[model samples]
Target: MGKITGFMEYERLEEGYRPVEERVKHYKEFVVGLTDEQAKIQGARCMDCGTPFCNNGCPINNIIPDFNDLVYRQDWESAIAVLHSTNNFPEFTGRICPAPCEAACTLNVNDDPVGIKSIEHAIIDKAWAEGWVRPQPARIKTGKRVAIVGSGPAGLAAAQQLARAGHDVTVFEKNNRIGGLLRYGIPDFKMEKWLIDRRVEQMQAEGVTFRTGVMVGALPSEGPAAKVTNDAKETVSPEQLLAEFDAVLLAGGAEQSRDLPVPGRELDGIHFAMEFLPQQNKVNAGDKIKKQIRADGKHVIVIGGGDTGSDCVGTSNRHGAASVTQFEVMPMPPAQENKALTWPYWPIKLRTSSSHEEGCQREFAISTKAFIGHKGKVTGLKTVQVEFKDGKLVEIPGTEKEWKADLVLLAMGFTNPVPTVLEAFGVEKDARGNAKATTDFIGGYATNVPKVFAAGDMRRGQSLVVWAIREGRQAARAVDEFLMGFSDLPR
Candidate 1:
């Protein structure tokens, strides 16, 4: 909290973006973060609401108010310290997270919430620019080895935490590079890969080893799971990891894409969003891709209207598609939320992303019926208007329609971690097909197999990146406690 009257004086300031026309021409980050003075103004708007719901709303429980106050006081160094205390990687969350913390801001009941995410972005960027983000290498080594399966946020967080605790940590990634979904699945225009690179360098100096192109367990050789990006040149069995490391944490993400198995599913030019997104990312990194997917001059239909779908729209636009259309099965939400009915909680309301502003047709309450194709290639698709009745979606009669398309990208979310990876460790899966692990303090993140643990999307289903970081940090404490009688790591 800063000035008591600041909330009434300052309107929330939004971070700016490069113009749509110019931004679409390149795969560089377009966000123009706030200046120091602007950040201080935003930070001053944080009112001491007695109880900060924003903290609890944040998945990692970042000390939002403290950082806000520090930023207001121009204590940039201390601000980063407070931010880093809870979140291992503020840069990632600051850019891509949906910022549910803002939704829970007390002022959000009547006005715009404090620009918490923008402040965070400013703090971290300033810290890096000032060379304040240095490696915290442990003075003494624990002599214990920890193996983390995955190089995503969860694995990265755990590896960094465990390394700081003096444990010898190794993170295995099946991809050719680090930063799992952050490296591949996310569009480069939203967040450049360099941010991840610098963090990886810091972790390396802290004694965390990263082994890319190495698979922890066998991936499925066929089907949807197989489509998940894998550049593994070397394979290590679960038993090998168990024998070599004192503790093994499976932090692999849910990689199995939810498929649309209607008629003509096998037609060419139909691809999963993951398939299309990653290739562009790889190409941006200067990697040569054979037969890379492109949307130039093609009418594209993107199914699923979540963040992934929005990303598809943006990327398709960047590819200079003739047209872009997105479909969401659920009915459109109201333009504004009834704050009294749903406040201090994430509400269901209409959300238009920056990508939507870039240009695209968004269709709500629509369901794809089948793909239309000729000569073994997808040319268009058929759809029907649907409405929920008795908790079931029913297609309306005479609402059927067909649309032409050259490419159809399925942006439906992921269902679960690849079954083969879980099966390899003999890990039990919950009803949702995620690793069975309770978050109870005693043995949270521990798998059924002795000394084996799981977290992130591998344990929970598809979720935000901040949640993954939280699970990873908590799991680090649990593993440290298991290794020693007690752990100094924060919960």
Candidate 2:
């Protein structure tokens, strides 16, 4: 390993952020990346641990120590190579992934973890700047056609792999953009849309075709209630897709958001996080929204304490909301986790996102009982303090309270993938309603329906972008093997 004693001499260095005052005014990436020298120093902090648990901690099993060592030795080209070998998009994961790898870092048991994520961000950004990143088209054509639904991380990953394996790959997206959630669901403040566009260009150069605004199920005449884009368009039918392509892959995301079925849910001001989030993204993309969900001069109440909720808070702040309050049903987690008990595994701890740092009123162990509204519009929320007793959530007496709220966003996570699409393919679903496809080597990602495969959130329910990438790549290998009777692609 380069710089064997570097860990003893150098301390971990973190990436900086733009000032809250300046950053809150606009929605753009604010993370200040490390300079070359600083990145090398951070990379040197990686211990020469014989067993790299960080590898297992990463969803895509990135060779962290190898890349760290390469960066330490000033081997920029090799570092990016090692990075791209495992991860299709380090830029995405480096920005948004929770970095479980750092949590499993041996140094994190006491001292700060190696700045692995930041180092990765630096390497990839450098690689792009130096023209080291380029499209690698397949050397030969396999002449087999493949159809992939949804253009999110999973579908994109799978398409890239299959295209590189010499198969004809076409990705179908319901939205007018190539990126599924990445284009519309995620805010630009987290990751710029240009990054996704660059990747799409690379994918197209690699021989993958992207068909946007083409739904794979029954075509809608007026679009669904939750139209991704304001420019309404007709949808495509499942039968048309099946008849056109030799093989089909269901990689659509879990779009059916979990709803709060409490009273007054039908209030006009109450909306799902998806309903609000995509509008902001569309506006950021320079679209003229008819009625944007503005938090301006309004007391915003974001229900459910998760990434989506945090996103709402940040967007609301950007919208100049009068106030933002986030509610969590479960009790607040400890500020720090007991490392001794949860080492090498993801631990439950209080995570303060950049949005939280900006400004937010966080309430824990609070449950919303009813949405107080008037004339079909929400005006306030009635909530109660909750306690866990005998494995059940119990409401505390005399803890009922109502808070003024002009707008309510339900940021609770997704329950399952939309069943209509899966039903169109006649794919079997698991108990959780996810597509029932095993990752075993024998059958790979094949579901009950022959010639059809599933991966990512469509198969595993809601998960991180990194996990989706891993699943997509693996599923591509499965498909390639099934189609060619043997696959040379990496697993």
Candidate 3:
């Protein structure tokens, strides 16, 4: 760790943010990073606990304490090395990760935890500015070709790792550009797309080839992905990929958005969160969109209370919606958590995102009964309050209500990967319809199809970006071992 008594002396300092008024005017990243001095102090706060649980808590198992200590000692280069050893994309995780590492910090048992994510952001930002981030191309080519379908975090990670391991890696993306969700699903206000471009450049320099506008396998349905960007100039069949590449990895994210199949579901004004969010992202990226979904001057009703719903609220506010209201089926959680009971675990407590603060009315324990529409377009919503009774949701009597809603966005969550892609590969699927792959230490990331592998959301379903990176890095190692009978890549 850092200073032995630093935990008692230094207070936890979070990163700053731009004023909401100025930030809402445009779609750009608003969170301010800590200065070098502030970051050093935060790093010093890491205590010398007998066991470092932050590593275990982090999905990628980053060497948190060592990096904190290195940063405290002003060894910026070594700090980044320690960070890059386990995690591939600290910048992405630094910006959006929920930071379970801080929750699992030993000092958090009784006091504020170390600012691990802030420190990581500082380290990587400094590394890039100081020209430390460079291509590490393999010295000797292994003469093996690997085709990774999807250019999201997982696919990018796997491609980078495999390329560095002396394999010829080519990433296939269906969209006009790479970065799958990072390029489309995510709003620019949360994370600028330039970050993805920078990494893509670095990956190219590292001998990783990227093929955009090339689709792999067949799309399951046009409805689920109608608003999604899939500007594929050509389609590559499963057999074509298998015959051309030594190995294949499916890292496409869980693309299907969960829907609300209630009355008036086919209404014109009702749309999935993906439909509304990606269009704005395209507009921000200078793409011409025709009849794009707009929330301007409309009463927007968003279903679901998770991050996606919050994103809808923020985007709607930016679009100058007349009113924005979010609904969550589950009961509202307490504002605070019992620290003693859940010190080392993700606690169940109220998590109001920055999007919510921008301005939106949030409703909890409310379930949508149907959409009220006029002229085949949504106009309002019908909902009833619900409560769990003996482990089952039961609607409360006489709590039904209707509220004006010109536009409705479904933001519940994704259930699984696109089934058609998996079916085309003939890969075994889990009960949840995700690509079936065991994550065991010896035989991890192996699908039923020979010479084919799966990782990230396609294998594990929707999850955090950090988890996807972990699966991708681990899957790269598995694929290397399968090809070479032994792998030198780190797990």
Candidate 4:
């Protein structure tokens, strides 16, 4: 440990955020990163716990202690190296990732956990500023073509790894831009699109070819609708993709957003979070959208009390909505977790995000019974309060109610990847409908179809960006091993 008694000697330093009024006016990141000294102090807080659970707690299993030590020593370059050794995109995780590592810190047993996320954010930002981050183009060419379907974190990570391994990697994104959800579903206010563009530039230098606005394999043009990329300029059949590339990786994420099947779902003002979110991102990227969803002067009701719902709240506030109300079907968690009972793992506790702090009414243990409308448009919603009794949610006897809502955004998470893409490739699907691929120590991540693989949400269903990165990196290693008979890439 760089500082033997640092944990006892120093307190955790929190990151700063821009004033809400100032930040809400525009869609851009407002987090002010820790200073070098503050980062060193935060790093020093990493104690010499016998076992570094923080490392394992991370989805990517980042070398947390080593990077913490390096940052404490003021070796910023070495710190970034240690950080990047496991995390392909610290910039992404450092910003949006819920720091499970911090939750697992030994100090968190009683004291404030080491500010690992803030230190990570500081290290990466410093690396970029000092020109320490650069492209590591392959030293040798393998001449093997790998096709990556989707350009989200999983696809991007896999593409970068494979390309650096000297394989010819081509990433196909159905959207007009390279990043899938990162460039669209996520609000620029949380993380600006430039961060994605920066990584894309580096990936390009590493010999990864990006083919945006291209959909590989057939997709349904109608139905409840899934993975609708209105800007896909061209379509490549499954046969063409399989024949052209030596290997194909299905990295497209879970795009089938779970819907509210209640009546009045067909109302004009109701939309999936995916539908509303992408439009804002498109507009942020200078695309003038027709019939764009607007919350201005409208009472916006966001369902699903998760990160996506919080994002909707922020976006709606920025649009000057008359009011914002969020609903969660489950009972509200305690504001603080019982740490003694939930140490070394993610805790179940209430979390109020920065967007939630801006303004919004949050309703817990509430369920939407039906959407009420007149003249073929939504005007309000019928609701009921729910309670858990004997492990079952039963509506209370007399809590039925109705609330006015001019706009409704459903953010109840995704069900699975679009079926057409997997179906066209003849890949087997799991019971959950994700691409079926085991994470075995050997011959893993391979799909039923020969030379085809799947990773991230495409294989594991809806998950965090950090998990996606982990799957992508591991899948790349598996693909490399299958191709070159061995792989130096880390797990």
Q: Residues 206-253, candidate 1, lDDT per residue (tens digit)?
A: 999999999877888888898988999999999999999999999988
Instruction: Report the C-alpha lDDT of model 4 over 59-168, residue by residue, as the tens digit.
Output: 99999999999999999999999899999999999999999999999999999999989989999999999999999999999989999999999999999999999999
The residue-by-residue lDDT of candidate 3 on 162-249, one tens digit each, is: 9999999999999888899877878889888999999999999999999999988878566674445688989999999999999999
Query: Which runs in model 3 stand beyond 4 Å of their true positions?
Result: 222-227
User: Candidate 4 — what's its lDDT?
Assistant: 0.92
TM-score of structure candidate 1: 0.99
Q: In terms of TM-score, which candidate is strongest?
A: 1
Could you estimate the TM-score for every candidate?
0.99, 0.97, 0.98, 0.99
Error of 3 at 306 (Å): 0.8
Q: After superposition, how far is residue 349 of candidate 1 from its true place, in Å?
A: 1.0
Cα lDDT for residue 186, model 2? 84
Residue 485, candidate 3: alpha-carbon lDDT = 91
**Candidate 4 RMSD computed on C-alpha atoms after optimal superposition onto the true structure:** 1.0
Q: Regarding lDDT, does 2 or 3 come out ahead?
A: 3
Off by over 4 Å in 2: 219-232
Number of backbone collisions per candidate, in order? 0, 0, 0, 0
CA lDDT of every candidate: 0.94, 0.89, 0.91, 0.92
Return whichever of 2 and 4 wins on TM-score.
4
